[model samples]
Target: MRGSTNRNTRRVRGVLGAAIVVCAVTTALPGAASADPAGVARTAGAEVGTGVGVERVSVAPDGTQSDGGSTGGAITTDGRRIVFSSSATNIAPGNAAGSERVYLRDEPSGQLKSVGSYPIASPVISGDGEYAAYWVLLFRDTKVKLAQWTAGSSIGLNCDALNCSQPSLSGDGRYVANVATIGRPSTSQRIDVWDWHANTKQELAWFDHTAPSRPSISGDGRFVAYQNGRTKDVFLWDRDHGSTSGPIEGAAKEATLVQISEDGSKLVYLSGTDTYVHDVSTGTAHLVPNVKGLAIDPTGNHLLYAPNDTAGPSLKLRDLTAGTDEIVSNQPASAGVDAVSAGGRDVVFQSTADDIVPGDTNGKSDVFVRRFS
Candidate 1:
């Protein structure tokens, strides 16, 4: 999702010396969700995404970090690669001394890497975890930059004539989408899609009279979703067909664009206190029950979310087809859920619950991952 603030399954040595074995037990909570069946299997929780692979994911282990932490949003999919914007210099090597930089944690190797020396924010990493797209502050202006982290290089996606932000990338890292302000006086904002590997960019949508905000892209870059100017309606762009469609019936005017399914048939949005999945072809909407912070899998078979009740929030994995809901986290996540893998097999969230992992005594919000087979 674009508006939220924003982990991995690799076994890396020299990290979290002791690993907690998560169970594959299914716990049933009846009446918790709509169309839910009984006894849905829920995966036990394991702590991951702590940057340093520690029991608790508070600032870096260097003890110089603070509780304020980084921004909340989709930093990555699959929970294998996570990138967060932070000001902590010790979080990664060669971090810009005083600027906020984007950091990536390669869970398989247990390494913390810095993307660049510029100030960055709201980074989104591809499903493969090889690339990251984020907004970087250069000089007095901010532009969207795409980094091929594996290659140790980055290039500005948006030109100097435009100020860009709110970037979204496909699972394979081939397509990068962003919103940028173009033209004089910077009154107009346009949505653009860049073929990272091809080094080509195209404007997907440009409303000379209105500005679109918050873009969500599908795994293969087939579909793109965003708000329709200043209206409550939402729109989806089909890159393959070069066609665009509507306020997507049933979407509340105040709904925030969330995720677009890989096939471009399902659109998810949040309106008021509820989240809805609209079938673009049928123009029908399904309300996800008792959960917020929703992320739908590319297949649309599973949906991941956090308990809507903020006072005692927890992570939930729902099987849309069988109508079953399973609690991913054994304990309440005081800081709420963060991101889910594109396959819905792994979920990353933050919690104040001490029992989520063994020896979690950091006494601060820590990140955890729950995995399912």
Candidate 2:
């Protein structure tokens, strides 16, 4: 996910907000992957490793900054906490000017907690607001970092990644789905799930040609949707049943998988200029209603995206359930949706257009959140 990450989600409040900046994972077409649905034989379990301990640095950055850009990633259930990446020095504690870093905006406590270095991809927040998960280039390879807010401690995942792609966590931070390299000096990789509750990591599927996109996990950690690293086709894996379903025929090349629903009933994957929504309840894989669609709510009932053939990027939201589309903004520059709040009531995106918000005269890209009732 870190090869080159394009970020999405969360809006700016006071310009230089001390929010966590994360790169959004993107994908392209790949070839066939060798998968074994019956390969629970390769499952390896080990005690969860808690690597070196580091205390979080604190800073207070409100609406006053941005010598560089910042991209927002996750928001807590209550929306009081935010995490994003930024290059500006003032918003993050102990960060050098222009050095990229991740910060958490705790609006309730009025402080910013540093998550650490620039992540390989955007870090995700648990719905319970107790934890944050993301990966970084630690030394030889990328490593996952789990930040605990309640305990005020940050632990680097001592486990070697199945692959360095982004990791997805459950709302409670109980399960994490990631693709990791299976053996050394070979391109083979497998989808690995780290269970925090059981303190173990399991191999779901071992295959080759896996891409760098994040293997999205269901909110409850029951299902996982991922793109074939080689084929660029999407696939769904069911944990309880120990089965795999996909390479989702016709998924095309290039995509970002939204977090799967807890029930595995709603799924959305936004590809370049394509929005693919698989509605199990409707029995249809609806495609082609929006361009460069950004975020999909947890329930998959709403989708935020850009309009095709429009002068400016007209950010629009589609009510997937009702099949209605409404425009959110028409900023004259490029924009992208970052994170959607719980139940899809709110969204934050980054944009270079300065006229959308009052007094946004800085002429640089800024993050903004839009709410829906």
Candidate 3:
């Protein structure tokens, strides 16, 4: 559903902008045209759930230390590196009291490095694994800015004076989409997409009294999926013509989380207690064989959701092709699964499962990685 322009909390900001440059190699995913169906399954292997596991990568600390607490984070398509926000001291800009700064973690190296020491959130990586983007709140300002994280630099884009949030980057890192709110509390909220390479911005469509927010873009940078109003109505933004498509099928006004496939041909949303998948090309909505969370794999082949019949929201994976479903974890009490990154034989998610890790369960959530055996 669209987000309201009304401020849920008072406006507070700390830092403005800081740019850092470094060096790193750029990696790209294989093109969809060359993707092999059977090869993909074989690569994922038969033991899809055995070696699969989750890691509590981030947490909130007792004091205001760098890397102190976890705010939010996202993983690369290849599942190699993770980018998140933290208040840890080793980072920079120190602790801004209640504000958060961006941090990057190299899974292979187990190194947690501070990327940006600004109040940044909603970090998303591109499909090519070459770039990252996030929404940064300019200290003491109501206007939110979009920053790009590449090779080793954080550059701010020209978003004019509009207030924006929830930034989503495309696989190629050429396009970025975000929710832009115009006017005030009673103002209008619409989806604004920018072509970074072209240096152009366009407003797709308006949500009437509802504000379109939390946009997720496809790998090809052709489609954008976002929620509208309280009725989990997910709409697809067509970048070619600057228009929106459908509310999808089986989607109720109560649908909460929404995600789109990498190809931009499928839409997934949470309807009531179940997760529904819709074929955007045919406008058909079906219950994904046996999965329940609001998150969908990048390829759109698997979906993750919280099961209602279970005690805590367990991580359920649905195989779209086989029409089969399986629970990844046996944990009873779990929070909602936030995201799923699947592409290179590995699938990872951000969840809160107490049983997965011992003692460290302080109610705060962490990132988990699972490889399909």
Candidate 4:
């Protein structure tokens, strides 16, 4: 079901020019191999999802989906371990104690597991598939949790006395950044970073206004980027320097931050439906122009954007480093992209297009993944 090709070697190099392999350190696969000008290996890559490097992911291994729909796909860099939110009661057996909220799939083994038995959202997984983070609305307040993807044991980083939401994780799952709402007469939002290793939590900053924006933490937990509730602006907090540089967004008209790179060097945000990118090191930001894409590679050097400028109806990987774009998917994704694998090689997204894959006659929103090399 999977195959590889050396098509577009130059464009592929542009996408993988960086030093971040992101996908489980480039495990073995069948295909010819070579080196880029930078000397990075260009292997024809092996089977993913199915044998084709692209396949429907929101279903049973046998492609059963009469149960329910799935959304919010979060993944490890290799696309081997994908965790997502779903309402399907039958994606896997028993659903990890009857949980229809979140599920994890081991693509190589064709195994799946449900997260819990309650309502869950915004599921996120570590780059190495070591942990997963998410929020649950058990009652009036939403609680944030970090769970070991293997053991399923978790610790609640719910801020103790406040309602927390929008949980984001560092690639290693050692750091979790979430928004907590507290205060009396008027509620204010504070972004908190939790260190799973040290078992300590620190408040990055607070806003006078309350909002729904999530905070993104870097892979090492050294940096965090968020949207200020009061001014509709963006801010970056450096834990190493204990400094906060804010309002980094230029002319932001209610800009909302979407994701930050694993290194905190790049950030993606939406300003009234238009996608924008901010280079953290240079303190500069710009609208992507013509298309909207939210997923960023680990190095913050690439993005999975939709409505390819030349391809017409497709998703493209925009190389921030080379200032070029490569259409990754021949079919358009209905809900844009969910995440990009390391080096921007694998792309998973939500699509209602039946033609995206053969036998996708479900005609409903389903998750699909495609690999580009």
* Best model per TM-score: 4
CA lDDT, candidate 1, residue 298: 59
- Per-residue lDDT tens digits of candidate 4, residues 1-373? 0111111111110010111111111112222222232334333333335433456677753445525666777767766787777766556554444345666677776556654435456578887777777777756677776666566556666475447788888877887888878854337776777765665677776666676656888888888887765567777777777776756665436666777887678888876656788888887786687666668887787887775365585677888878888755566564322387777776667766666554555556777666665
Segments of candidate 4 deviating more than 4 angstroms: 1-53, 61-63, 95-99, 183-186, 251-254, 272-274, 308-311, 329-338
Angstrom error at residue 95, model 4: 5.0
Each model's TM-score, in the order given? 0.72, 0.74, 0.72, 0.78
Candidates arranged by lDDT, highest first: 4, 1, 2, 3
lDDT of each: 0.57, 0.56, 0.54, 0.64
* The 10-residue segment with the lowest total lDDT in model 3: 28-37
Candidate 3, residue 77: how far the Cα is off, in Å: 2.2
Model 2 scores what on Cα lDDT? 0.56
- Where is the poorest 10-residue window by lDDT in model 4? 9-18
In terms of TM-score, how similar is model 1 to the real structure?
A: 0.72
RMSD of 4: 12.4
* Greater-TM-score candidate between 1 and 2: 2
Off by over 4 Å in 1: 1-78, 94-99, 117-120, 183-185, 208-212, 250-254, 262-265, 280-282, 289-291, 328-338, 351-366
Ranking by TM-score: 4, 2, 1, 3
Q: What is the alpha-carbon RMSD of candidate 3 to the true structure?
A: 9.2
Give lDDT: candidate 3, residue 275. 69
